[model samples]
Target: MALLGGIKEVPANQNSVEADELARFAVNEHNKKENALLEFSKVVKVKEQVVSGTMYHITLEASDGGQKKVYEAKIWVKFAWVLMS
Candidate 1:
């Protein structure tokens, strides 16, 4: 999957795509059962910035029951270059 705008782009693999869809469906269903006021929940925006080296700072915007919320997450990615002899 290619990272775009911070929201990890959906994986190209069919199985991964299916799994993501299923997870979203499950969450929606669970919300419906737990709270009648929540109509739906979805991601609104995503931003990513490099902190240092392979570390990154990610910000996520989302809405739940019409209320907006922001969340922060940190991640580290490693890149390797191989030399063939």
Candidate 2:
């Protein structure tokens, strides 16, 4: 499924399970690396690009120090590895 394609927006709804999970992972990873406490809120948007596996660009809202803020995260998931930014 790695035919390589341009980035495209995926169907993003409030109940998107994969997007939500990725958002959570992004927040957790960020908290661990930055030592900043951030609470995962919800996924606001989702996009994907076919890379070696798949690159997911997600926009999410999270509580930062009790303030709700929107943030962007890029996660490259290739089954064996997950890179977050």
Winning model by TM-score: 2
Candidate 1 stretches greater than 4 Å from native: 1-53
Q: Give lDDT tens digits, candidate 2, residues 4-84.
A: 578888876633998888889999999999999999988889988888887999999999889999999999988567699
Please list the residue runs of candidate 2 whose C-alpha ends up more than 4 Å from where it truly belongs after superposition: 1-3, 79-85
Worst 10 residues of 1 by lDDT: 38-47
Tens-digit lDDT string for candidate 1 (1-85): 4443343433234344434343345445546787643332333333333333344333334356678655443445455667999
- Considering every candidate listed, which one attains the maximal lDDT? 2
In each prediction, how many residue pairs overlap at the backbone (N, C-alpha, C within less than 3 A)? 0, 0
